[model samples]
Target: MTSAVTGRRRLMGAGLGAVAAALAGCSGRSGPVPRLRLATGPQGGPYNAFGRALARAVAESGGRLEVVPVATAASVDNLRRLDEGSVDLALSMADAAEDAALGREPFARRAPVTALARVYVNYTHLLVPAAGPARSVADLAGRPLAAGAAGSGVQVLAGRLLGAAGLTGGPAPADERQLGLAESAAALRAGTVDAVFWSGGVPTPALTDLARELPLRFLPLDGYAGALRERYGPVYTAVTLPAGAYGLTGPVGTIGVGNYLLAREDVAVSPAGELLRVLFDRRRDLLREVTAGVRLEPRFAISTGAVPLHPGAAAYYRSVYG
Candidate 1:
């Protein structure tokens, strides 16, 4: 029999055991089994999908470390949880991670967070009805739209996008709704909303499924990426969503944000580094869940912009290049 199966028995144990795992891993080998809580995003999102795969990889590696994936609002929520020490690991967008680390807007205080790696790029998507009058962000004025769930990174970016387009606090600001990916798609199909803003992996599963049922018209952000980059830091970049996605005739230009696997500064070094080892080795497992083009490159993993890499993860990268 294979000994690679995963377990959550530790989570169901006594509070004493929980106290013992205050830090996920030990400095050296041999200690209480490392069990970590990973804060993933909503169910119909890439963070949750990739996070689950990582958990399985950890279990299947037959490693001493165990990870439990906790579902919540994306990026912002994940960072907050990591800050409070509620979860040992988190998945977040680079822009949001930058905000949290710098005590910027949406984050009143600096979060004690560091990156494990830059896992993937989140393609910002703005979808409208195929036959709707809203062809651009400006056209969405006074139109009802879903801007991702509250406390989510999508919402923050949505606000930023709208603000950049001069749509916020104006005479005709967008009628914004806070809904998760699945709910937003359903709203769009049902004609309850005119547009939906989602920042996720390319070929996002929920959006793809929505395209099948309801024809979608993706609006191009055009120059917003450059505009945003000037206001923000290097977190925002121009990226193209190539042709054939959602049956589009040609490519659509959009903003791209790197997604980072994050952890608290005090998280132990051993399990943190071990998690990356299992992650890169089991990269194929994530492909089963994330978008087709989503990849984990060692050099890109260390390119988390302003967010500093966790010492453990930095050591792992050093070991890799050395």
Candidate 2:
């Protein structure tokens, strides 16, 4: 639980007030404070848990800052909210952030969003009934599938993988439904959906609960990592969900996508700096809610790939790296 992030006395050229605030974070705030909204994911998801945890940590510190967590579709939805200034901070997948930054398919134009930190990796999960006839991604050609919630990173990745498997835009495309993780789990339990696509930290609470309640099987996605990386970039990685995760007897190979904390281009330096300081200083407290946060560290946090870091984040990194 100790911070691997050590800082030198040098301010890394950041504004004096900003760097001081960041370093002095966690002290209970006095009176009025700046309120910032953070866009997280749907209920029962990692983003939601992390957002609430961060808010609580800041609150417990009695800081002069207030962070509010807003539930959304996650990833792309978060980025869109950031673009419109509806939210000051957001949690997003690196891939979706890249797509939005580069004006990719779902995004007609580039978005003005910047990174705060690389939080963790999301392990893609394609779960089906254990005893169901469908055994592979291709087997669900004509079946009903929960393709993730609307405007979510899960849906974006699911579409690409499904199209590559020839399950979409075919003679009998999979009937797709836009459902969030909780809704997808409910739909699967009701037998209304044959398979559900979820991309989040391993042992996502909802998925873990679902696994224990109903026998479930994870479909292997080991084959598409290379293709997705080739077509897109290094944002995709081949990772395996080890045995015992979700109480599974065997390992499941899947695609792992980087998750990032981001902010709008216009976010001021003080709020951003204060948040970063609190994040590194109080990360262990965050892990009580989102276990994936255990993976967050100074060095790893700086690797946001194609997305540029916010000015405050850059300063924080410089202070640590120096």
Candidate 3:
């Protein structure tokens, strides 16, 4: 594994160990700490880092719970893991979660999961070589493009963006690449691909690193938000990346979709409530580290779109907001 993945695994293992030690001395009153498995995204993506922070927070909260972070393909794969009972919680894009709840294309039947909270907004990044010929989504037609990995939420958003731009398969249909964030960045740097569609938070780690090594620009997609939402539901929204967010000169307008933290319906109410309490109580600790965690506010936390909130999550919101 890469150093980053190893680091995340070590962080989670340490958290679990701490929880186990704490629970062992608890006089057997509450029994062993409740172990909850969280399905996170690929190593280089934001979800993995954020999940590790959450696991650490829960471990330190003195609550009767232990969170284990499991790295997996994002969204589609995470939801599948939740359905299979392999994971207790997952992070997913609002659209994908809605599809799973409604028994849509990628899902064969409704999934038994409930939303814990709405997390950050993932911006659709149409990244291109600064000196390359492509100036807009239209310019990328027939050119090489990386639309994220096959099972990732980025791939779904990429298809929607390309379709909105009237580029069904674009030019050189075979040139469309389905690569992960790390692979996509390397492909762009090596001149293997002309452009890439990455739907992620502003200043994505790989993109930020790539920008330092090469000149890059984000194409505006604010115009397509309407059409995208009209077809895909209200899950799509307009979001802006301010100037200097990723060392860019000016603000870039883009389309974004909310990310939801979900849990299986069977997870107990008390542990779920404790998880949310620790999440917000230690929010600043997370914000100081992960930029994506900055969006985890209590107000936006309740906006989970069509997915219903878990009973424990609902109680947490009520106790705080009331």
> TM-score per candidate, in order?
0.90, 0.88, 0.87
**Backbone collision count in every prediction?**
0, 4, 1
Q: Candidate 2: lDDT of 70?
A: 99
Candidate 1 lDDT by residue in tens digits, 1-322: 1110111122223254343343245334586778899999888577888889899888898778899999998889999998889999999998999898888888889999888888888899999989888878899998899998987999998999999998887799999999988899989999999999999877887788888888889988857987899888778998988898888889999999888999998887778878988989987557568776677776677776666667677556555553
From the highest TM-score down, the ranking of the candidates is 1, 2, 3
lDDT tens digits, residue span 1-322, model 3: 4442353233334443344443343234456677899998998578888889899988887777899988888988999898899999999888889888777868899998788888777888888889887777887777778988877888888888888887876444425688998999999999999988887777677788899999998889899999988987789999887788768899998988888889998987667777887888886666444454356666788766567777667656655554
Model 1 regions more than 4 Å off: 1-28
- Alpha-carbon runs more than 4 Å astray in model 3: 1-29, 169-174
Which clashing pairs does model 3 show? Answer: 142-171
The predicted structure with the larger TM-score, 1 or 2, is 1
lDDT of each: 0.82, 0.82, 0.79
Evaluate model 1: give its TM-score. 0.90
lDDT of 2 at 190: 93
| Local error of candidate 1 at residue 42 (angstroms) | 1.6
Rate residue 287 of model 3 by lDDT.
Answer: 46
